[model samples]
Target chain A: MKSSRPPMPQLLEQVARSLAARKDPALTGIDVETLCAQLRERPPPPPAQPRWQDALIEAQIPEGASVLDLGCGGGELLHRLIRDKSVRGQGVEIDFEAVSQCLTLGVPVLQTNLDEGLREFPDQSFDYVVLEETVQTLHQPLRVLNDVLRVGRYGIVSFPNFGSWRVRLSLAIEGRMPSTPALPYRWYETPNIHLFTLLDFLELTSEISARVVRGFSLVEGVVRPLGLNDNLEADESLLIITRDPPLA
Target chain B: MKARLRKYDPPNSPTSVGWTKAFTWRLTPPDTPWQLECGGHLNEVTVEYETYGELSPARDNAILIAHALSGDAHVAGWDRDASDTHRPWRKNKPGWWDAVVGPGKAIDTRTFFVICANVLGGCYGTTGPRSICPETGRRYGLSFPKVTVGDWVRLQARLLDHLGIERLHGVVGGSLGGQQAIEWAMAFPERVARCIVLAASPRLSAQGLAFNAVGRYSIMNDPLFLNGDYEDGQGPDAGLAAARMLAHITYLSESGMHQKFGRRRRVAHGPKSGFGVEFEVESYLEYQGRAFVERFDADAYLYITRAMDYYDCAESWGGGDLATACRRVRAEMLIVSFSSDWLYPRAQCRDFAIHLCRAGRPVTYVDVPSNLGHDAFLVETDAVGRLISAFFNPARKGWSI
Candidate 1:
């Protein structure tokens, strides 16, 4: 049967035109090769090692676990598990090219937007569902987290902590959206239309009745637990959450 | 022996194929040989790679440099007097990825032997969609089996075996090359001592995939594609060019664009003038697209991009757990991100570090402040070079000095 989809080139042309017209001034024109070379020449900053998430996952995931990766881009993370951890996995993404790339890489990825819902997948289908840097983009972060909690035995959420004093200061003093290395885009062009801080996420998790298995902030790549004593001035943080109580 | 070699030579004067050359080496996987997921076929495929640096004795100093999209084995320092305007390994003049891989540079040939391979589905000297199928003399074209990062990594592993190297000091790559670096550490943890993944992510971002999809759609939509069978003059040049243009845009940053060609009039002296492509940026994009099509194969473009699209490490684990994937990775990893690179931003690199830390893997993450976007990894050589040297330097570990 002939598919009803438009021809690929025409669709691409339309998208190309739109992209060109809507090119972000902040991201538009630069010689990348030249710039990349320059960046490579400098000494890298001190390494930041985050160890908390590693401990939590190791303690939680049993042998031969099934995983579902939301917004699995380029299969880097997914491929890591398959080859290193020996875990079975699947991914869902809204981008057709990404799904195609995933398929090319031999990853099983379904091309679908999470915000639209995952009716195609049955409830409790995966041992774990991970949302890596995906919370900020969703129009409804709470619903997506709820759905992720429902589908997997455990959930992992990681995002830049907007509550960090640096970000808050940028908002308070600079009077503009913060553009840290973690969140580089300006207010008008930011992909994160729905911004939330680490504390905001915790409150939402509580309202949804999700229990925080373990949560920590990454300082210079080192994973440290989120606490009042610790400095919240760091740029990024990761949170690992689970459903409350025991499943009957 | 010389007389015997001469006797075996062809009667007619050998005509140089000109501009391009390819070489392939058969590779057997360490585990269960490569199986094409699309058709479930067990296949023994050969990886075609090219070399830029001389090998040294002891062979412990080899640095395998992987290429990103539209890049090949021709790292740099090509013979300028070579017959072809387009050097054997590089298509565009001056060559892409040349800024960092030459002598006296970050990946200095004096220190490390560099070997770069045209990826499995690449148009350059590699077994790709353009290559004639052994079974059916015709090119595989669209019929070529889909390839994955694992497939590429397996091929590279074979290349390493062929070179008689049991272990590598480091594997450096950006973008897709970065993906290959990640796979190398995962697939053969013992083989790689240090890995540098630059401006690369653990998986494809939805935004990134959307861009890739549009690029592919642009290519496949051309009527000349002829369902992937356009072998003659009627090729999908327009679509391919459009795809290249779109991809070229992603490689650049808006700040860079503004700095280089903001609202500038094109052909300032020419009578054939208008607002169309009046800015230097538009002309640059056109030039990039036009130059790209002169060498790249449309089918290979489709296949390779598809491979990138399908890349997801977590999917294979079935648990959707990125941390689990890194549990077994033994190599010390250095993940770098550019502040300006929206394509594969710092957020993605942070995500990778988070998972690696969660898996109890030793990883160093650096978010370099730069407005160079994703391309910063290539051009910011001085910065990246120092980081790599320090990271790999065993003497510098744990000591503030």
Candidate 2:
């Protein structure tokens, strides 16, 4: 929605015009365009969708549960959690514009690079730690996963399934780095450094001695229980893992 | 020198608040003396304040602004008695914060009723060292009780009560004013719904305290200081000016200073002079110091900067735990720090935000990229205004994703 207020650049221009009309000395050598350029922030990109958000919401986290969202771009999912489930939500994001949006949405956020690790949070400080569509982009996905398990009772992770039929077919037939809707960036420019399939994700959990409490296969906005064929059928996967055994 | 100062809103500008009048609120009577943090009591207390915009029927649209050390209650609009007042500095300029507090500016006086008051121990018609004491018919001078940021908030709350405002929609401030905003949140969380703190931290660093000490030393040691009891027109002007000149350096960035006056000789071809303003930067400081001495009181400077030196949010509010103290704040907060403000570094501001978040408080921290130094909060009005307007009215589409 467009605001009734003029954007900052327009306001500057209006001020300049008014000053010129008055022949005010303040307008003598000032560059309104340059001032406007300094104030302008790059426009934010539209948020993408991954069905894990829907699945997470469907899981219905207990009221007032503490949640920590890593790489919470624009804080959309966290905002939903706080509004719908009454969970205490905090966000960590590296993007300046995204952090500003989170604050505008009344989300508690810290602007710090996730590569530094979550050293600020104590063990089991949060009831749930969420990593959405941001795992493959990390330098050490396994180390972050371990830290997530250490800092939260449950870790909810969502990532694109590289073994999906479409991705595999494109790589096999086209003989080029695959570009699907989920992973649209070219190989040279892609942020995903550790792309893995659902099976690979399950193997990672076992490698860390973590238990998969639940798993879901998400395809074209439809969510289903993880099945034997999910390694190739699922376009994306959402896994709920924990260091401790599942509660009775 | 005149060109260096900011341009003010014309008397007839549509966005200008136009003519404004100051009001005095007698908060404390002789019988009911107000208590101070130092265990001193004020027999009589008065606060000079000004308000712009109309209060909503519900009285919920009021935003209280706190000013920095050298600021006054005249936050916006042309002071009606500027020329009549002793302080000639107020004659032409609208107000210190007129940039963001006009009719359609950042704080948007048209939408929110804004109130700003001259702080205690200030010379701007507020009860201070210069005001005649009720108990002793003479100027308080050095007899004035010490004031803290907490005391300022308490007195402001009384002022609000007098105005019949049970709660504030927001409290906004920069520099020392920012500390007041933080104090308001922790001291009276329920009173303020939102707070915007620009270019401030939990407390003054050791280095900051040292610099303040030197400024105070300069004032007290002036040959004409007369132990802070000199005549009204003759007390420590030289001392105060020197102190101001020294402080002026801290408020600027190295790069900003270099850009404005990069080894430029004022005379262009002057042989070695004994001791005068030869360098452009020195000339700039001399003007600033002289201008500051014209409007500010030497005794009040000692008292106010002492108060600033004493402020420590963690020690006062949280038993020395910032996160614990932050737990007391219920208001949504927006903390802004400038990139080049070495006086209150961005890292310190970040730590403050971190503690607030650790306490599970709703806070938005932004380190705005600027080379304007500590004074960026005032100079970078456009950026600061945008953040404040967006924070106050979140429904407005200031940033999209």
Candidate 3:
């Protein structure tokens, strides 16, 4: 999606300029002695706990299982596995900082460009592979799915559905990219390099000889089974469980 | 005050010595000996530091830059020689932290009086395992106290007190330097207004500890270690080199290694068919190790690495709750992590940020995109400098200093 805002560099420069212009006295008003006293008096704050994904992985992952988490930003998903599942999970990321974050967390992660093929991992390297909110960002969704199927016994893919009637209506009426909490950034700034519909994914899966183990839609953060009359065109999110065909 | 010359100098010193030729100023803080986590004890300790910019009349504009494991107190600017030996201030070597400490840079010497001190267990001017023992008047060697991160923080606090600068604008560092920065904010939150922690963790991971352990083991197991008292003229240069090589590998990324060496052959011709020092990477690592040995002490390496291994901020508070540990911090913080740095990855940094956020502290977290590995913070000068400058900009309402 083309961003409505200025280019990334220009936006960053603007932010920097705005920050540079401010002169808050609270930071500058204190005397050295007073500041030292203040520093000694104040203690540091606590760390944040994991969110919903952590809970989901904890409840679902079997003990001692090997998992592959794609687009695992900062290795948070792998950390959840290590802490809750005691599972050894590897992550694939394109961003260097996110990989560093994984290392700092002490989780094993491989740096790979997801748009390309996953030739790095041998076939069936993982019992389960998860692609969380990552499919929409891929330029070649089928290639990723096929690769995941090759490396994992089971695959969990989640994506925001452009086929949702709300999104369709928004686009039809507003003629501008929709910006919901699910899709926080403007079109030009969004990392959703490629957007796909549920039907498109299903078609790709059918062509790749993958079988859907389970399918569900999430609306207003509630997960429910997808029924014939479910009207996925209005659902906010979708999750699919698929299995790759046995070798040969 | 002129920089003091070392009382003893070994013969055959290189004629064109590096920056050490330029001597500026020095100060001897009051001698306060202390014990280490290890059984060793030190009777007297001295800290060496350097300052840039001016201390305002009110002494409120002081910024402290903590050095990494191998860093000294020379943060920026040139030495007396006017050459590029200490080019942190000039555009030369750029002083290890020149990006963050120059006139218009993030730390901005023009506005903030910046002080960078070599850690307590450092081989620099500070007293460490390499310093002379007062009782025997010989280099302490193995007899030096095994210091901890806490001890280093305490010494820094003492230095601040001596300077009569009660509060700091902020404490900034990356890698081990980041450890010191976090400790300063936690230990004396009221004394520091802000903290910039880049490529650091609340505690050293087991993997990190393991790497450090192997590095230390390499040095200690060297036949030449001689139980740490290798002062008989011969020392564990081989072991130290091996340790440096291993640790250096961690500092860089796989891609970086490929780009730097990529199985390229060295100029030397020997055992080309076998596993000799044929790769350029091997030669480069050797050069790094050899250069390190010339300026560093083996005993100091043991103390510092041991101190790093023992670094666990959660242990200091009570339980292993990092958020609880930082509950009292009033300082704003900026926690930065690099993408390719497998050493201190982004998840740990995010955890730090989450904890800070949970504790209701204001913090800005940036995961910079880079493939330079842990060393990215030092090499990605433009991005880091921009973040630091923005973080420390005095005009910002919440963090003007």
Query: TM-score of each model's B chain?
Result: 0.85, 0.96, 0.86
The global C-alpha lDDT for each of the candidates, from Candidate 1 onward, is 0.66, 0.82, 0.69
Candidate 2 docking classification: incorrect
Best by lDDT: 2
The docking category that best describes candidate 3 is incorrect
Better of 2 and 3 by DockQ: 2
Candidate 2, residue B229: Cα displacement in angstroms equals 1.3
Two-chain complex of model 1, DockQ on C-alpha atoms against the true structure? 0.02
**Docking outcome class, model 1:** incorrect
Instruction: Please give, for residues B50-150, the per-residue lDDT of candidate 3 as tens digits.
Output: 88778999999898988888777876643444343422222233356655566666677678888888887777778777778889998787777678888
* Global Cα RMSD, each model: 20.1, 15.0, 19.8
Model 2 residue-pair collision total: 0
**What is each model's TM-score for chain A?**
0.72, 0.77, 0.71
Identify the runs in model 3 with alpha carbons over 4 angstroms from their true place: A1-248, B1-31, B35-41, B81-94, B267-271, B399-401
Each candidate: how many clashes? Answer: 95, 0, 49
| Residue-level error in angstroms, candidate 1, position B133 | 1.0
TM-score of 1: 0.57
Strongest candidate by TM-score: 2
| Candidate 2 error regions (>4 Å) | A1-64, A163-178, A193-197, A218-224, A233-235, B1-7, B267-275, B394-401
Per-residue alpha-carbon lDDT of candidate 2 for residues B248-334, written as tens digits (9 for 90 to 100)? 888989999999898988888897766987888988999999999888999999999998998898988999988889999988888
Error of 2 at A78 (Å): 2.8
lDDT, candidate 1, residue B117? Answer: 81
